[model samples]
Target chain A: MYNLIMKDVKLGVPFIFFLFPVLMGALMLIPGWIYFIVLLYFCWITVPNLFNQFKAQNDLMFTSMMPVTKRNMVKARVLVIVGLELLHILIAAIFGVFTMLLYPNLTYLFFPPNIGFWGLGMMMFAIFNIIFIPIFYKTAYKFGWALFFSVMAAMLFAGIAQWVGIQHPVVNDIFYGTGAEQVALQAIILVTGIVIFAAFSIIAYRLAFRRFLRVEV
Target chain B: MLALDVRNVSKSFPNFQLRNVSFQLEQGYIMGFIGANGAGKTTTIKSILNMTRLDSGEVHILGKSMAAHEIELKQEIGYAMGGVDFYTRSKMKTLTDVVKRFYANWDDKTYRNYMRAFKLDENKKIAELSTGMKVKYNLAIALSHGAKLLILDEPTSGLDPVARDELLDIFQGLVADGEISILFSTHITSDLEKCADFITFIANGQIIRSGEKEEFKESYLLLNGAENQLNQVKDRLISYKINSFGFTGLIQADDFDPSCGIKAATPSLEEIMVYFAKKEDQYV
Candidate 1:
């Protein structure tokens, strides 16, 4: 299962690189703060799409023929998704740092004047990962249109959250507010997000593993 | 004792259904799973592997219910799918290593021998290998695990003649130990004719017939004669097809008389398959 996850991550490297320029280019038009939305979109889109393609190519058939169980297959896929999320976060953070150094005076568009933007980014990623991983896994198991709809739904929910965060002043302040107090709050939000993501991921893994166990190749 | 027994297995999808399919493969025997495309050969294999849930039936492998002893059962079995998909960017060695980690009984010496036999370079990426080579690699992985039962679904589907021959040889060598049982599914009957100890015919998602190779061959005779001659033997005919030259029909050798100017020739596995597939159509 670890090998399967690693193989998927390796296969996804080129795709991650392909997205880098587009992501960096988008930063020129949108504020750095809004880049979190792009990062979330990247995670939601790539993870499931890769797995769907893997299935279409009949990878599951070969894998199933191995001694591995359906439970292991689901676990491997979930681990790959988490790995991809981490890859995306790492790359995006690097880009964020680069963007800041290159354009130091440029207003951190996504982060409020005083907030810890990195922490907010982590929180947003955690929330999206929590919701999207299970949705995609269930949809992928059902396959075909179900998989497509689930991904679209995940993206739509993430979009709405980003929209609400950017539009509402009170909500914006809670996430983007600056200073020592807000910094501490951002840290709390980041930790809470990690905890919730971990809990949800476990639930998703169980749901997906059980559902997929019943699935016929 | 039977190495594998599938009892009254049934499974259905919206577009297809497999009903009450049952067959047994004895120890040290090769059972050819003969079926045409979409004939549920893969489905049946899936059920045996517990990869799919049977609507109602039980499968026993090595004297244990598949549901109760899946992992234990699978560990003793090796498999090669019809379409062997791999992570394209992964090297052959990487795949071997990954699969090796899962099986405690993995034999690296046997695996390396197969790799050399098939001329597959461990350094090559999976995507770089040809279809036949990929199949060979899949077989190598399957054989390396010290499997007691090798279940192959069209293992020779896309192979060239040489590769197919080499695979047949490997199978023969593997079963030479007389401890490994093979359940191989293939539309190409020639391969099975050479290596299979028994043959199972599946059509329209059901098993029509299964028995020892010699017995299966002995039961049917291929008769070719003029229309008039065929008419005289028509009562014994299981099925027949007419061509402009005359008529050809399948009959029991015992029932076919040589005096009718009809020659009774041994039916090849392909000929038998056509006969049964046609029989299936007639029932529909």
Candidate 2:
């Protein structure tokens, strides 16, 4: 499995790709940008670019020839996706810290850069994983529809969560209120979101394995 | 134990079907899989490697079920599917590094020796290599890991005579120790003629004939005559073709008719495959 992970690593992506999230993270530095859009940047750029690398090289054929199981291939692929997702998020979080430092009291139209916000990002990614992986694994070749549905789903989560933050008095107050009260609410959402993330990701892995077996590569 | 035993293997596509194809390669010999394009040659090879799912059948490699032991079986089998290159955009070093890690028996000395002998540049991207160079590079990788069985699909199709001969020599060398076995599918009959110990011919997804190479060589007779002589031997001929000047046909050596204006010559593997590929009786 480690070898399988290294296989994707050696098929190095273009340098321009690694820069995508950092550039998106820079958007948060703006005085009053909606942070929800910044979260969308991770899936929008990362998934499409990763799939392109796969299609261009015909990666499944290469991996199938090796002494690895189809199950392990899915495991390694999920790891790579999650690894990149975390990398992009970390870069954005660093920029989020800077944005907060620069404008400590800015009015946030979207959720502020708080622990719960990242927690929400994890849930959106989980939604993307559950939808994208099984559908894409069906053929393991065509990805347009998988990307389409997953993006819509992830964006919907971000959009709905933003609306709740803006309009619901109780939810808005809990998120925007002073440090300790907000921290307590945020901690709850974070734990809940992490739970959803882990659960959905496991479901995606099993679904992907079953669908991938039927793929005729 | 036989190196390979494909029993009653079958697969189906919407428009075609591979029905009950079977053959075996004993522990230390070569089996030449011959067929025309779309003749299920590639499909059979894919099934053996479990690259394609088989609807019904069993493939045993070195006495283990290929379906049940694909991952473990692969460690000892070196497979190269023709025309499909691996990680073509990556450098040779990058691709092989990933491949080498999977085989516990991979020897750096053997890999370097092959690299030097083939004059392969480690940093060169796979896509940049010519067809012959790509085949050589693939062979180097397959041979470096102490693979017990080499399954190559059409490794000789698009090479100059010299390069093809070179590859055949390498295969012959590998099996000389009576430890390694080979199953190479090819449309190029001459390569098989040079090194194959056994032969299996497939047509329209069915195995038409498979046996020892010596038996295969002596079983069929190539008959030659003028165009008008086709009728006299039509019933006896397995397949026949009529050109402007002459008619050529393949018939079992025992079925030949001396009075049909047909003269018999030994049939080559290419002659046999050509006869089998055409669907209708008068296949011209």
State which docking tier applies to candidate 2.
medium
Using all chains and alpha carbons, the TM-scores for the candidates as numbered come to 0.84, 0.95
lDDT of 2 by residue, A1-217 (tens): 9988777776745556667778887887876677767768767876787788888777888788888999999999988777777766777778888988999878877777877787888888889889998889999878899999999999898889888988999889877665797888888887888789788988998999999999888
Per-candidate RMSD, Å:
3.9, 2.0
Model 1 agreement with the true structure over A32-142: per-residue lDDT tens digits: 556656555655556456656676556666567666767777888777666655656666666665665666666543553222444544555555555555555553444
B206-227 in candidate 2: lDDT tens per residue? Answer: 9988999979978999888888
Best by TM-score: 2
What range of 10 consecutive residues in model 2 chain A has the weakest lDDT sum? A9-18
Best DockQ goes to which candidate?
A: 2
lDDT of 1 by residue, B1-284 (tens): 78899999999899889999999998887889998888889889989998888899999998889889887888889887756565777788866776787787889899999899889999999889887787778778877887888888898888888878878888888788789889999999999988889999898898877899888887789988888786798777878898988898888777877776787888998998787677767777
Model 1: lDDT to the true structure: 0.73
Q: After superposition, how far is residue B102 of candidate 1 from its true place, in Å?
A: 1.3
TM-score values for chain B across all models: 0.90, 0.93
